[model samples]
Target: MEEELVQQSSSTWPPPPPFWQAFTPENIARIEKSRQQQAEREGVEDASNVRLHDLPRELRALQPPLEPADGEWRVFGDKYRLVDELPKLEDMQIRRLFPNPEDRDRDGKHFDRALILKRLAKSLLLNFLELMGLFAINPEAAQDKITDIRDMFINFHHLINEYRPHQARESLISMMQAQLDRTRAETNAIRDAKDKTERIMEGLGSLKFGDELVGDSTPQKDPWATQREVWASALADIS
Candidate 1:
């Protein structure tokens, strides 16, 4: 059954890579070359793997800084360069950061703020690139760049902080406008209710009560008025 399944799969048009022209003369030659190169690399690595401690002191020693007079200490010592040596950034990367040339201009007042931010970004990238390699070669020099990076970050945040007052004012204005709209709606509702009440009172005034009950000649006192008078008499007795 497994043999039948294998046959069925292999019969498809365009077999998988491992089965497609795998045993061709060109493929076999390529595979042999790859294996030979891999073996050569392994042999080279094994030959080069020497124990550092076993080597003579002179072979494993760094030259005295003073003897070189301006070389060894500068390369591998506790010295820092006064000016930063920045790595070159590609033109494409720079264009992606600031596409418009006018944005790079610092003289214009309107573009000045953006110009500073772009320059800060450029400085950060340069320092980051230098620090990547400098940390392994010179940690102190790498740490020096960190201070500038931090200052630039702080300046960026300061620029952002300038928008706080504007944001707060906009929020307050939006809240007050919403409150005013609600108050106006409430006022309109109350005015509508007053108008409806006045209309109902005018309708009631137009009706003639005497015409509706003409057969009854005697006048009757209102029950609510009698009840009020009784209450007033009870209060007078209490007094």
Candidate 2:
């Protein structure tokens, strides 16, 4: 009977059918419903995983109102007054530097006053420079060239001190000279290369016009161009 049952199970006609054969329309519908329910459960779980802080406030009153006027309010003794005066002083300085006749009435005639203040600032700065031994021949000569007090003070502190510890003044002069030298050298080199390229092109043009001269004779590339190609290949190999 067991042998007969095994033979029946093995028959191509089938006893009940394989597990895959059992997957009918109803079975497929049930599977789809289960998948949809699982997807909904996962979606709920994902929503729960999101942080509370990331959500928009349900109550608007929980968030603080913007306060732009807080910036305008003076905090701590005379700090705000000093901060307010800085813009007025800066305007005054700019007016003194670039004085306009038309805007005099609107902006106020503070040019002369600004100029006097600038001179006084310069004198005080020069006194400091003199104490630092920045000037050799004349301190007054150095004061005449100083336009921006902030820049002057910064250069005096950092550039002069750090770069030129012993001879700050001399180092400053040397730096300017070196910059000029480098500019001149670069300009001359560029000019020379331009002239050389023009000469090479003129020589190439003079060659007689024929297929023999210009054709398959491996178009004469510039020496610099050939060198650059060779250098590129070498770099590729190294890389």
Candidate 3:
């Protein structure tokens, strides 16, 4: 059995000398130098390849110039609702006080608080005038009884002085509210007519936008004013 055994050796049993060599400083320098030379030779051989600066004229011409990135912009809020409620002029009791707004004296009318008050009184006391006119018999005897009516008229004058502005302010607010409602309806109709992709924004500035009512602000026949003759007549009555 020993005589019959054969010896079989493998040639690839151990590594080569280069594989077993230590990384010395000089050897590393020499190896790096050889690698650089080899890389240069390869690059020269690969003529069709190009670096960034060496891009061909045609390729470079096709590429667009790089632009600076835009990372900021003006920003607006997506506010889309009314902030404050519209003035509720519908429930206000001002239209009953001064139905006419076109009456005004050409001279210093806005400053004439007394004249305005008196005119407002007369307009509000039409019923009393009719009553006084109806009971015009026995002028001297009825004067004492009619004195009550005069006193009542003076009381109404005081009431008008006290409450007329409040009424006017309310009327102004009411008219403004009506104007706002009309404008809102018009705006709504316009928006409805627009395409679906459009955006409608609200609540930017003041809640009461465009409050000018134009024609009706001081309309024809304003009841808060009187002719100077009306003042003379009232004064004569007082005397």
- What TM-score fits each model? 0.33, 0.21, 0.24
- lDDT computed for candidate 3: 0.50
Question: Clash pairs of candidate 1?
Answer: none
Q: Which scores better on lDDT, 1 or 2?
A: 1
Q: Residue 224 CA error for candidate 3 (Å)?
A: 86
Comparing 2 with 3 on lDDT, the higher-scoring candidate is 2
Candidate 1: residue 198 Cα off by (Å): 3.8
Candidate 2: minimum summed lDDT over ten consecutive residues — where? Answer: 48-57
lDDT of 2 by residue, 1-239 (tens): 99999998777664552444545676555444544565576665443232223222332222234444544543332334323322322343432333233554676545453454465567657766664464666656665445454444443333223334447677888999999999999999999999999999988866766434643456665658988999999999999
Leading candidate by lDDT = 1
lDDT of 3 at 4: 30
lDDT of each: 0.60, 0.54, 0.50
Angstrom error of the Cα, residue 205, model 3: value is: 39
Best by TM-score: 1
lDDT (tens digit, per residue) of candidate 3 on 1-239: 54333221233333343522445565545444544565587665443332234434433432234433452232232222233222222243222332222444444446445665676566547656655665775445656545545554554454455556678899999999999999999999887867433432332222433543433345555454678669989999999
Q: How would you encode candidate 1's per-residue C-alpha lDDT over 3-116 as one tens digit per residue?
A: 877886777453454443345665555544544565576664442232223323333222112244443335333554444332122321322322243344555645455676
